[model samples]
Target: MGEVLYRQYRPQTFSEVINQDPIKRTLKNAVEAGNIAHAYLFTGPRGVGKTSLARILAKAANCLKLKGGEPCDACDNCVAIREGRFLDLIEIDAASNTGVDNIREIIEHVKFSPSSGKKKIIVIDEVHMLSKGAFNALLKTLEEPPAHAVFILATTELQKVPATIVSRTQRFDFRRLASSDIVPHLTAIAKKLKYRIADEALILVARASEGSLRDALSLLDQLASFTDGRATLEDAEDILGLPPFGMTQDFFDALITGGEAKSFAHVDSLIDRGFDMAQVISSLLQYLQMVASCKIQGAGQMESGLTPEDASRLREHASSATHEQLRRLLGRFIEAAEQMRYSKIPELPMQLAVMDFFAELQPQPSSTPSRAIPKADTRNIATTQNKRGRPAPQGALLDMREEIVGKWNELLEKMREYNHSLISSLRLASVIACDGETVTISFPYKFHKEAVEQRKNKLVVEAVMEEVYGRAFRLLCLVSAGGLDQKREATAEPRVVEVASSLGRADSLLDEAMKVFGKAEKPT
Candidate 1:
């Protein structure tokens, strides 16, 4: 029954257009100098005033009383163009009629003078949608249009348009409106409509619009109607399907401060409120990024568009954590975002991410002192596990695991000389236990396990071990359940004396080690 907000307030002059200063200036200069090109191309993101500017260009060039290369709103040419009743100003939806025949219709009329206005303006919106043949048909018309005819083309996707067409036309890129620009515009519209909408509501709408002023107005209009002109931030957020800011803050505090219960509680609230898990994770990532930026660049940046007090609260919350911690938390949140895409219960990914962050924060034991093995001897560290291989005592296996852990990297490198893919498979596998002539290693992924246990790969692994030990050892590969996180821990480090007593050849290894370390192996 009424005009939409975006259409109701479309800009009628170059000066009135929002946030496209360079484009406006260029077009205005051309008009003022009577240097208008036969064809003009406008390229930019959607909802950034491409189509609107094309219409304004038409009105400006054809206006009876053009001022400084801009159309006067009072002029007959400008008013009719604004009201969409100007006969000489033709707007074609190239998206619907994208064939050669459709383009020929325009070419057939090119020679005719303006029906009423000074210029015959043809505005082709989404010109990139025109068929290849249609573009070919239109190219000639654009290249050599009648003196009184002007062609204006607009496209959201600049690359799809043929370069030949682009080169012939004068080009202008429309820039997106910033939130700082969007917010005030919405506020002014709300005031004009006599809506009691809060500034918070306007900011939410502006952010949700993401630089699209048309979408921003549409959202504000929705909020105003839903609230009967008493719109609040909560109403705006609910209508826009945004996650609650308070919950995001709570979740951030819980995750960074080792409050696992509070973290899950916040997740529960978000799930109960029907907010998407992806949105929650996304908001958390943004929150951490802002806090990290504040820590590095000071609170002056306020990149998240939060209120000053909220920013201060964020800075205080982030003060307890180091930049390294914030970065790690951000990483976990990002990982959870990807996982959410494949997860059936989307909240499960976020929950798992929360658990992992807390687990990383858990205190770790001190590093156990290790004996330096000879570089040549380091390759003896057995690679991985297969349950079908030789078995041994728990004590013996634990002792061998200590040896394996000490030189795991060396073992992997030596195996790499035989088969790099074998070594790559082993990267996902870790020595968990051992036997007299066999070692047990667990692989996190089935593909790695399957790849390593392939008959040929298994032989290479065994050969590399034999080369290292001067004796044969069976290669065993086991698929570890639950992936890398579920891989078993290495055995506890035994005392040096105990290690020597158990290995027996630890005495020989120690003798070889003495030359390397240039020191005697102490009893401790």
Candidate 2:
């Protein structure tokens, strides 16, 4: 097989490392000022040029007559180091030889001066992997090395490196290359290699690489082989196993508006295609997050790796769901993803999650909107359901010919606990006429007459009557002396009464007194 693209074209000079201009500038100035440290630590994520830059820095330090703070790439020292044949320069992979014995060898070599170059250089990659004993063995040399030796250590994890070693060296942090930076670099490399690749294909590779230039170039190399030197979007997708962007969006829309059955269908199809449940959920979460981003910052500014058409589809789906609804859905998917690990049937939980999401959403009413009750009208106006099953017309008067005395003495007893005065008047009155909506009561005295005329009292009595009979009725307080006299003569013999109870009297009071006094004289 041919040499891989990442290794075949690795950066050879300080200017070639991408997305780390700050670290390069500082190192170059240090070199120009002749202030290079005896030991240096280069730390960052993978494929960010930690080891490669260490080699370059080593060549620059040992280069004869360095200029412009950069190595003279044409010189014997630079070319020998680049070809990995420099006698005095040593590169160790600490991952495989992390024991103290490997470190002891280096410590012993530090006693000798440079044989061919200006300084003997040691580059230990993944230095964090060294055992505690090995680190201890290297500590003395690291603190006080030979004047002709330089140490350059590189690691991806900075936290694992001991503070003692870190405190004794100069540290440089290399940043990951950004997508915008990685894309152009990959595009250029693709063209130089005579491979046909589009900008979108390059972008996909850049995003998948996730800020590592070497990973991007590696992916490009893989794609070139898979596509027979013509890398296209389909080739990238096939190699990476990424689902089409449109399918994920349609899955979301079908879940939201297409009902439970359609959503189940979509999930079945996804399963049939052998898509991993974990990958499906992860992609769904990312897609929902993209929708949420568009909701917050307009759709014109989504940063997802999706194309314009996919972004448009996302915005359209988002329009159907409110922010709260989407938030709830996201939460459900997260919970499902968590439980998916322990689930016997992963699709079962995911399917129920979708069903539950739809089931929880309430459909709006079609016709009447709920409203508060309006204030009631105030009138002495009484309404009744006549024999014809309709409201009686206005100004309907009560007929008084039928005499039906109300049997309410027990009711009167109950009312006395609430108000003794209302029950006292009720004791002296009788219902002489009754309509379904109105009742006429004849009061024996003016006090009773005045008490019943109070609207609050009348309303309370009317409400009680409605509760008792299931009908609304009104009360008429009438004072009558002749009517009481006529009833006394017909029912029983009249009797004389003494005038001992009279204290104060109005004309209505006198009329009310005679009516009740006359009724009391009747023989039962």
Per TM-score, the best of the predicted structures is 1
TM-score against native, each model: 0.69, 0.62
The residue pairs found clashing in candidate 2 are none
Query: lDDT tens digits, residues 269-354, model 1?
Result: 88998997887787778678778878888876464556677766788876777977887688667767866766788798788677
Q: Candidate 2 regions off by >4 Å?
A: 255-264, 277-282, 299-308, 317-524
lDDT per residue (tens digit) for residues 300-366 in model 2: 6364556677766877876777897788679668766765776788686577567546644534110
Enumerate residue pairs that collide in model 1: 384-440, 384-441, 385-440, 385-441, 385-476
- Those runs of model 1 whose alpha carbons end farther than 4 Å from true positions after fitting are 259-265, 301-309, 325-524
Model 2 lDDT at residue 334: 76
Question: Which window of ten consecutive residues has the lowest lDDT sum in model 2?
Answer: 366-375
Q: Where is model 1 poorest over a 10-residue stretch in terms of lDDT?
A: 364-373
